[model samples]
Target: MQLTNKAGTPVQWQDYLKSGHRIFIGSNAAVPNALIDNLIENSAQLHDIETVHILTFSDNVWAKPEHKDLFKVNTLFIGGKNVREAVAEGRADYTPCFISEIPTLFKQNILPLDAALVMVSPPDEYGYCSLGVSVDVVASAVKSAKVVIAQVNPHMPCTNGHSFIHVNQIHAWLTAEQRLPEIPDQQIDPVSERIGQYAAMLVENGATIQIGIGKIPSAVLKYLMNHKDLGVHSEMISDGIIDLMKSGVINNRRKTFHKGKTVTTFCIGTQRLYDFVDKNQHVEFYPSEHVNSPVNIAKNDNMVSINSAIEVDLTGQVVSDSIGHQFYSGIGGQVDFVRGAWLSKGGKPVIVLPSTTKDGCISRIVPHITEGGGVVTSRGHVGYVVTEFGIANLIGKSIRERALELIRIAHPKFRDDLLQQVRKHYWVPTYQDNTPTSVPELGAVELKKFTLGGERFILRPLSPADERRLQEFFYSHTKETLMMRYNHHLTQMTRENSCQLVSVDQHKDLALCFTQRDHLGEIIQAVGRYYFIEASNSAEVAFVIRETQRSKGMATTLLLQMIKIAKKRKLSSLIACVRRDNAAMLKVFENAGFVRGYSEDFDEISLCLTLEETITNAKEIE
Candidate 1:
């Protein structure tokens, strides 16, 4: 074979190709279109030629049925729309492998490459040509191939980091000045935007995020505009990051690894995105082996891996690669980043998806993964699963707890069906009946966060999923505290009792809890509840605070919110029965405008508050 020092024609380079040669095409936006066209133009010159690549934005003519006899195509990840039908029809093959391990396949000769066709930027002053937008596994393929042909494109961005190769490394070269392919920005739908909002809440300031491309991920970036010192350590970066970088939100100033640099393996977006990374010192493109390695990714503290999934079961099993028996997409870097984030300090591994499919007829949160569906992320690996409804933290949860948490975030229409299925599987107790109730009033109540005595606490409507936590809260109180709240000595709280406490119908009555989150789960600090009395158009109210959390204004906050909710419900009056010796409880009710009421028992004091008259007085407590 003759190696050419100067630019050569495709026809001249085609002379060196042989039968049964495995050719690797550059992945993502850096595909060599001219060389791909050359192969299709001279298909008759080669038989049994194998082509391998990751994702390509070009027209996959080589994978079509017409070229089946001349060429065989294998894709590392099935993301391109044009190649799906061919893969499903067996005209093309899908190879499942983690993006981080693809380089090992080439270097170990497990998938030996006879030749590699790549596109690169023009050589710099030192004769080094950057791999440009896609370094990924292409760098390894070029190093392992027996012959390397390059399409030198002036349009390609000369990215930083380990994205360059010496010009002498190519066996032959040709110039192609065409613009790189672009993935048009997908329109963000309402469902995707809502999911993005919930996913963004899990990301903290000074956190490193690994987000992919799509409407949901793009929406997430939109919500992150106000976050401080965010960093990107992802397998791919798209147009979404450009705005965040410009806003100075993602300065990479606090990243534990590769501080002050945006690290990625590949890129696909509009021309503006390509131009943003061109010779940009802050953006560095590395090989997948280095960028997607779990160990390397965990080096960043507070790593939040936000990835999308096709479907998730009640058991927290995530299926992303396939739909039933059909292959939809590849495993990609989801598992790599999930585990990496899970291993990091203060990390959050989040899997986000819309509650239902695009049609809204089918629920993505199912009792079981579809038959023949592949589980890309197992139950043990799942952390936080977010949907439009809310976020479910699955880490350290039991099967029953996982089911309840997942059901809480599932589409409302499917919650009952999912509950029935979980019962059939015996994942939940037979007595468990905390399927979420849909009420218009429930939607109006937003999650509230408050700080008291220098500690942060969250106040929200008590959920049926909080049965276990409520029971734990019951045990956390001292005997004296329980007696004061219940007006009797209460020794034990059973699951049945705990379930009833959390399962109040919001339409008729109210139940709210003050909570603080720790590593184990959410801990209930205080609880306030009410039951309606239809005869007097009044409600019986109660309050309970943990022994250690009392006198910290938690009870006052819960009481104030309860009054607001009661007024919203149009209740005429509120009544409470407290032990005469419970001075603190009396003071809270008195401060909230409750007046003394007649009581038949001497050991207890009855208090009443007229909802319509106390509106002004309740504000004074705040």
Candidate 2:
């Protein structure tokens, strides 16, 4: 790698990044540690430096815990190590995104940068330094940065690869002999190996591939050596790909974008693979923005991206790095590849996971996500979901159908419970002719309960084992449902309970009640929602519920239950609201001794149940 100034003039040791310049560091393991060291070393002299890095590894030593006043690492995704401190200690912040669109953040100047720090191998006779192992959007960083510092390393493999900066392309150089951080060998489990086989089966000869790192990704690569011309335009590559390369599988000659070039951004593996990627012209490694960008990635048709997950709901909500509320990993490139592959002609972005956990106690698929679970790829963005059982093409499906499909593929022991959960959470009637309505296209992944001789079926709380069926449910219904759940708001949903169990023992002014779901096996479309039935002074009362599971009678039942419980916790009159067209709902309030009120707004009707009136009604009935 060589250095040059912005005006095409070479600088020996110029500080291109001055005050007020926004800087973009490579995301993940591709982050330039040398550049970060330089920034840390020079931080005392710099002010208001906005640093950007996506899903970076343990490099936060430079985003010093004590240096918050000087540097700000504004991130789009929250990786595991930095998440805890970021949410609580307020260090590195979280940005919600699918991996597919990160490059847009840079190209669109959503977060502008003043400079870019890139790491590369020494330029070859052709006068171009290879970006080495990683290619994800770093090219966008290099393209947008006001200044560029090329850090040339000798130990880095000069493999002919993707990342590139022609000798005339860069602005400055900080030559140093540095070691690439080592990532231990990724070991795959037998189940993951099966999933890898399934994922690899989807890849055809002459297909261009994009893959992230991890057991599932590496395992998929392990099974791909026998395939032919399996070109790669990926963000990162590990040792698994080396075997494929040596076997003459990843030739990249037929690739439409970087023809005859295996493109990538960063790589991690044993030195054997590292040596394979060094300054190799056949391999062109660049920045993530270029490699991961939907535009750049879309250039290669038949791009197949294989990613993994912590959990995938039946409705296609992918929770790859988290368990409900806790942050585990960042959304790296799941969405990027999913979307890129979706947009590419004949492309497929696949999320591969095992059918069950180690204990077989929990299914990885689910009808819905856990509480506080982040929906990374809203159903629309997902295409295929694979497990050892089979593949489910969830695109354009109803959540109901998606849930059904997910259930069929779930671990046999856990499928029924997951299906029960789907019914409860989705509020859907039993499937007819095996055509469920959980898919988003027919309707959004909603509670699909329609009248069955005046009785309605309702889905309750969803578990992880119901993902496929939920995905099919989205496909089963009309797109109207998707827009309602993900796009449009079908009803007003907000958690109204001040007396939540979470608020218990806070010793605050509110009376917090302990809500219990001792029965995780309870069947409903969702945990309909808890109502904080509140009774104010002068015999006034009201109730509120959360948004995910509205119109499912939790509020009405909770209100009636509250009236009894409050009679035990002691209260008088109870009041509630029922949208006029909500006939079944008005009956719930009326049946609970509430008197319907004539309001100017029929859409929002009021109901009142006086204790005196209720006692009189009980006496009359007696």
Candidate 3:
């Protein structure tokens, strides 16, 4: 298959073409527009040529009815409007495959490529041209193809890693001074912002993340400005991360794999992002086979995968690539990252989407996916599911439990209907009413940050998922602290007890926890909660802190947060029963405006904070 450029006006690339040839074009923004134009211009010269690509732009020209006899299009993923229509009209075919395995399709000759037209950066001093933004499966395609053509552009960024190829490997080259295309940032809506806030709470400092490109990913990054030492191991990235990198919030300092480098297969972003990656050693672009390899991704500890979904069922099944039976997008690298991230030590695989669609007219959380919908992610693989309303932890939950958990996070307007469906489907215990009974929407609880002793601390409402953390906190407390809080000696803190401690009934109780995480992971430093006393406007409050964190004003801080929530709830007062000998606990409650009172039993003292009086006093002082 030796090839040589023919002398002509349009470069006569047709001279190198033949009937029945299988050609692959670079994906997304890296599509070789110049080479493609040449192919279309000479469409009359070839017959039955097969063209393969993923999420290509400007595909309508090639899929036109006039070229039906000459060319047929095969898309690995649909990224643009034209290709989607082409697929719907039967003008083109689509091959649904995971992005990670697409490279293998070429490597194994399952889809042997005759030629690969790609865009690349100009050859460096060593005669190596970088693949620029779209390495992905293009690297494998180039290797498997008999002829490789390149549209070398000066504006293309010369990224490192498996992104570079020797100039001699290309059969033909054409110079281009044009700027590469860009996927502009998406507008972040209110639903996306709420989902992002919850997703960000799961991302700890020093965790490696694999985020897709879209409005949700953009929104999620905005809330992470305060996070530290984050790393990227995603398939693609956009402009949202530029500020984080510049702010030193995402330094990739603690990654277990590819430490100190941001690894991605391709990038779809504006010129600013391209300029930042150009000749930047800190960012490495690898082939999809490598970047999306689950084995490779799992090597990074604390991997947090954030991906979007179209619809999820009550059973935790995720349908991301399609709406009902219609093809919307490709499987892409979502499954790759989801499985990889969950397998990583301390990893969190999250699925995020709005609870409703179409102006809140439809619920995305359904009892079952539309009749013929595909499940991109199975129930077993799903761990965390976040909607604008809340976060649902599905891992290790039973079918009955999953139904309850998902319904809890659904839009309130639809929860009642969803709950009825759940009850009909499963023989779960009956509730008094149709108001959805679920593990509280803990992720919706706002996180308050305060500085104590020059160290920042986060206080947020607790969720059922906090059972494990609460257990750790309980075990970490000394016997003396435990006795003071529990009013007796308790040696073990079981999961059931921990779950009860964190569970909030929204109407009757509100539990808040003070948490902080280091290299080991998130630890509950303290717990503060107020439970309603039946038939009374006043609530009983309790507080506990780890021995190591005591005497740091943490208790006072928790007390203040409890008071604020109680006041907002319009509760008349908050009461707490404390041991007479627990001077530290007594002082904390009193310091936060609590008025001490003697209990009927002398062994314990009652601390009460009258909200109406306190509010009046505060207003007066102000």
Query: Model 2, 1-622: lDDT tens per residue?
Result: 2344546465433356555567776655556777667656656567667777666655565466666666676766665354446644666666766555666777788877678877777878898776665556666777777677767777656645445678677777666777776676578877777677667767777889887677778778877877899899887777777778778898887788888877876777777777776545576666555677787788898888777788888788888756788666667767777778878876787888888887887788977788877877668877778876555666665776577667655665676577677677653344321221121211111122232223333322232323332333334433444342233333322122211211221111111111211101112232222233444622333333333345545545445434543444345555655565656556767777888787776557778776645532111000
Clashes of each: 0, 138, 0
Candidate 2, residue 567: how far the Cα is off, in Å:
64
Model 3, span 1-622: residue lDDT tens:
1123423134456656688888998887788877777667656668888889887655446666777787788989976777787777898888999999998888788998989999899888999999988889899999999889888878888888789889888878677665777778988988888888878878888889889777789889999998999999999888988999999998999999999999998888889999988888888999988989999999999999998899999999999888877888888888999989878998988999999995889999998898768898888789889987667777776786677668768887897788777778662345313343332332343555666666667776676546667887888888888789988889987766665665566556877777885422457888888888767798998988888877788777777766766777788889999999999888878877788887997979998888876632211100
Cα RMSD of all models vs. native, in order, equals 2.9, 19.3, 4.8
User: What TM-score would candidate 1 get against the native?
Assistant: 0.93
Better of 1 and 3 by TM-score: 1
Residue-by-residue lDDT tens digits, candidate 1, 331-442: 9999999989988888888999999998899999999999999999999999999998877888888898899989988988999899999998898887787676533443
Model 1 lDDT at residue 577: 93
Look at candidate 1 and tell me the lDDT of residue 178. Answer: 72
Superposition TM-score, candidate 2 onto the true structure:
0.61
Which stretches in model 3 have alpha-carbon errors above 4 Å?
1-14, 431-445, 448-459, 462-509, 513-537, 542-555, 577-585, 598-604, 612-622
